[model samples]
Target: MQNVLQYLPQLLGAAFKYTIPIAVISFVIGIVIALITALIRISNKRGVMLVVKAIFRFYVWIFRTTPLLVQLFIVYFGLPYLKIAGIAPDGIKLVPFTAGILTFSLNTGAYCSETIRAAIIAIPKGQWEAASTLGMTRRQALQRIILPQALRTSVPPLANSFISLVKDTSLAASITIIELFEVSQQIAAANFQPLLMYSLVALIYAVFCTVLTFIQGYLEKITSRYTIA
Candidate 1:
């Protein structure tokens, strides 16, 4: 009990410094990637775009189908060996933090792209037509009208994804990132109280996720208000 209290700050500190930051940064980047991918995949043009769409589809498929841990290992460990000649004779090598961010962003983006795409598709075709009738270009319709509605509908799922991402940041420990879970592991090793330390960490994660859940509810309420007649 005394030891746990003593080390509580350290555990929280790790979360503030590494865990939260990693998740926030990764999720932000992931959202951008997801929005772009979703937009591109749904675009009507089909010239060179066919090639681009296929590439994005394969990327999403590969990330969604593979284990995240394997993805981390590939980014952090395997990439260093793939020599790239002039681009990089020694291949691509990323620091632990960079590797974690890269993997998490891409993985989350792949999943969130599907979520966003579904949300966009859920918008009524009449909505698009309405925007067009207002003398709006497709780009203007998407930017000014379509995306706002999609965002409202997508908020819950996207928030859920963000919460899951917060928990998943613990996996950064596997690659020597020394995040929240790793901090707990280190303390447990020292105190020889693995059960207590693990439980404590889990509680922290639950707390963080609970806060996110509340935020999700709040957002859902706000977004749904205009729909309620």
Candidate 2:
């Protein structure tokens, strides 16, 4: 018990430094990518929209169907082999932190795009017609009316995605990123107490997830007040 207490601060501090940053940065980038993909999917142009739909569908399918650990391995370990085969002048060689961010961002984007699309679609068709009757262009209608309402509906799903992302960042340890779980592993290795160290790690993750859940509920309430029945 004393040994676990002694190492708790170090493990928690390391997690705050490494894990939080990776989750925040990756989720931010992921949100941007998701918004763009959702917009592309809804575009009215026939030829361009068809091409984008095919590409976006394939991207989402691959990322959603595969395991994240395999994706991390491909980014961190497999991509560098291109240089060995002389396929390119310079093969990609990403450090663990960079690799973790890239993999998480792409994976999150693929999943979140569907949530965003559904939110946008759920808005009533009459809302668009009402905006057009007021002499608003399509862009203005979306910006002034459609998007604001869609954003409210999107909150729950997007918050859930963010919470899932917080847990997923632990996978960064697989690529040697040295986040919370990795720190726990190192401590366990030296003290020969894997069970205790891992228990602490799980506890910390639960606390973080719990706090996010509270925030999600609060946001949902606030948005609900503004939503039309």
Candidate 3:
């Protein structure tokens, strides 16, 4: 306990340095991908719908089926093999950070797409009709009316995704990325105090996730005001 307290600042500082960028960038890009996939999942055109659905289905299948560590290894260390033979004579210089972002983003995108699709569908058809009557196109109605409501309904799930991503960032360490968990591992190895060091790591994650929960709750409260009864 005393040793953990002594090393808390160092562990936390390293953890923050590694986790924050991975979480934020992955969440943002993952949300964007999920939004596009959700739109495809809901679209009406046969050609557009078929292609998008196929793409997303394959994408989600591949990512969800594999362990995240395998994904990171392939992206960070395996891509430059036969896949990119002509593109560059040299192998890909896969950075750990880039690998971390790619893995986290793709992983989160699959789950969040379903969350987003459900949210959009949950919106009332009356809202769409109201928007059309007010001189809005389908796109406009989706942008101005349906999406806003969907966002409110989507908050809790989206928050869960973000929280998961935060913890998942620790997997970056497996690929030589010096994230919080990796730092904890190194400290534990040196001090031979695995239990104490990991407890601190868990505490840090809990604190961050708790803060996100509060923010999500507050946002949900605000968004509820605008939700159609």
Full-model lDDT for every candidate: 0.95, 0.89, 0.87
Give every collision pair in model 2. Answer: none
lDDT of 2 by residue, 74-100 (tens): 999988766755556588888999999
Residue ranges of candidate 3 with Cα displaced over 4 Å: 89-91, 227-229
Tens-place lDDT digits, model 3, residues 20-46: 889999999999989998888788778
TM-score of each: 0.97, 0.93, 0.92
Worst 10 residues of 2 by lDDT: 80-89
Model 1 residue 114 CA deviation in Å: 0.4
lDDT digits (tens) for residues 87-198 of candidate 1: 9898899999999999999999999999999999999999999999999999999999999999999999999899999999998999999899999999999999999899
- Winner on TM-score (2 vs 3): 2
- Preferred candidate (TM-score higher): 1 or 2: 1
- CA shift at 109, candidate 2, in angstroms? 0.7
User: What C-alpha lDDT does candidate 2 achieve relative to the native structure?
Assistant: 0.89
What TM-score number comes out for model 3? Answer: 0.92
Give the lDDT ranking, best first.
1, 2, 3
Q: List candidate 2 segments past 4 Å from native.
A: 83-88, 227-229
Candidate RMSDs in order = 1.0, 2.1, 1.9
Better of 1 and 2 by lDDT: 1
